[model samples]
Target: MSKILDKLKVVELTTFVAAPTTGRMLADWGADVVKVEPLEGDFFRGYGKGLNVPADTGENPLFDMYNSGKKSLALNLKTEEGMAVLHDLLKDADVFITNNRTKALKKMGIDYDSLKQKHPRLIYATITGFGDKGPLADAPGFDTVAFWGSSGALVDLSIETGNSYPLNTPAAVGDVASGTNLFGAIMAALYARELNGKGDKVTVSLYGSAVWSMSFMNVIAQEKYGYKYPKKRYEVNPTAAPYRTKDNEWIMLTILDHDRYFPSLCEIIGRPELSRDPKFIDKIALLNMDNRKELMQILEDAFNKKDAHEWHLLLTQKDIVHDILKHFKDISTSEQAMANNYMSEFAFPNGQKAMLAKPSLQSDNLGEIENFRGPYLGEQSISVLDRLSYSKAKIEELLSKGIIKQ
Candidate 1:
């Protein structure tokens, strides 16, 4: 039998990363997701930062990841005729998602109040800059403000300090978090619908999601710690962080479980005497030594005695927390990811190979799928309209009037 979501339908009216990425995950789960786009299509079509693929003769890698396994229809919601098409589709849509501004949606009559009149059971989920009813609600949001700066995650890491090594986390921090918001809201709304016999409007914003994620830091700062990024964070954790081996290779060795592993670390480094030293004897005391120069200098010299690979094997056997600091290529070719089916080859529009996240499934229950890449602009407009029971003549008229793209 098909999975739980196989019989569901999702109407994705989103662009860019956050919202569309959530919709894509639903599509991968066997939902009949129809990606509604503007005439120009969703803006993420070229977000690959020059890593574009010419799929179906179109260059949109972001579109590929975010819209695969979904049908598409291009409609100009600003037009009366186009709104009619949306109304017709709403008659059967199980979930409707959009990332447009709240004011614009209300004006267009696509807001929850308006749509609920037509489809009372449709799950409505949305994303915004701040929120629909906050002072900063209308402020335009980008990934940077919402994810990096607002979250205070970057600030806590002390990334800006000149002495720190490579810092920034990958992109889509807020987007990823907000996507989680969308997914959770959808799940909860689905639950509510079963109980109340109606769907509800669920909303999340960049700022809200960022705030939710930074709760721990906020609590610590407000209560016990005067939270501030250290002037030189590496100066504090240098012994446990990456250091250049003799061959100029970076390696990280963390043996901070002082009472348990300090003796073993000392034996491994041939420094059996350091464990008995008063300066290094007290675990809590040394941690507050206020100066890690001695610790850093000793570890640096000890690590330099061997190359990264050699140290990796020796430390690993002793159960000492250590790593050679591998790169993305190392993980991509990793046997574990393949054995677990977390990553797999995807066929791009150009018939080239690409990496894509595997669909969620129990390993034994999964079956083959037609994993087509994303569509061109309005690629299935005519066919999609026909399926909606629109007459050919009326569809042509709407296209001619530019209410819907052909």
Candidate 2:
């Protein structure tokens, strides 16, 4: 089957997770994505080393996860020649995605307004730490600082976890979410372009994404009957929380239909009598903080009586909506992940195989996701320049002048 984005072309000037994530999704749909990086390479190409990843191979799996299958064009963007080369490349491209700050983008003359004037039909998507028009517009925003720290997600999450010390997020949650949003915006802009014969300036921010993710709680906290996030013991829906098992494994339940699921949950935990108890007779009664705390204690004690695996079987038999809190490695080995093509076996240059996630979307016409390795620095520099109609001698001269790298 032909790929959905086979006719599309993208120019990706991005680093780390967010913008690259958008490019990866485009590539997954078969867009010819050219990743423009500095001569030294994207900073993320060396980020894996900081995590103590073994240096035995040229592979940077972390980088590859979001960049695989994209062509690399390493050039010195600070140089006028390099900027001209980028302009040439963009003249015929369908999309341009970047995560550089407003000042950097303006300095490079690649801001949305500038690009839109130059190429009215080109989709220009920009990702920032904060929205582009704020006092902190040019501030450096990594996902950690902008998304978690500045967005109050760290504080809000710590409130639930009962940790006073700000907690670290799993990893790149904000960046990835922001990128996914950008992808949707770009798609929408593409659809609009089809009708209007002109593209759009799409922008998304890590702070904005983080806020959107937790807007419900924030909304409630500002309302008339405002309330802060409750502690686990005070959670109104006691069944919809995590409980520790005999094996010390945590199992999370999402029994959202409190009235219908509460009785069954109590029965499955061997505390059936609690279901008929007066204080816990209905969802309204359960909303009482004191009553909820007592019920949470009861559930916690009952959960501690069985191992997580044993509870999993019993819960499955009861048709309960619950899951064992698994580590990352456990998720990598999940049967559901494999069955749904959520993960694919990625073979690295070092002859090692690791299962990496396929792009998030799934479609019948989309073939099996390939595990193409990410390009080395400037891996396609010469070819890209050649395709842009640069002469061989000019390419050599540019390389010698440090304007481009291969």
TM-score of 2: 0.95
Q: What is model 1's C-alpha RMSD?
A: 3.1
Report the lDDT tens digits of candidate 1 across residue range 162-271: 56654565667688678767877897888888899898888888888878887877776664676455435335554467777878887887877777777777788899
lDDT of each: 0.74, 0.86
Q: Which 10 successive residues of model 1 have the least lDDT summed?
A: 361-370
Residue-wise lDDT of candidate 2 within 212-281, one digit each (tens)?
Answer: 9878777877758666654444565687888999999999987877778788888888889888998888
Scored against the true structure, residue 178 in model 2 reaches a CA lDDT of 94
lDDT accuracy of residue 253 in candidate 1 = 75
Each model's RMSD to truth, in Å? Answer: 3.1, 1.8
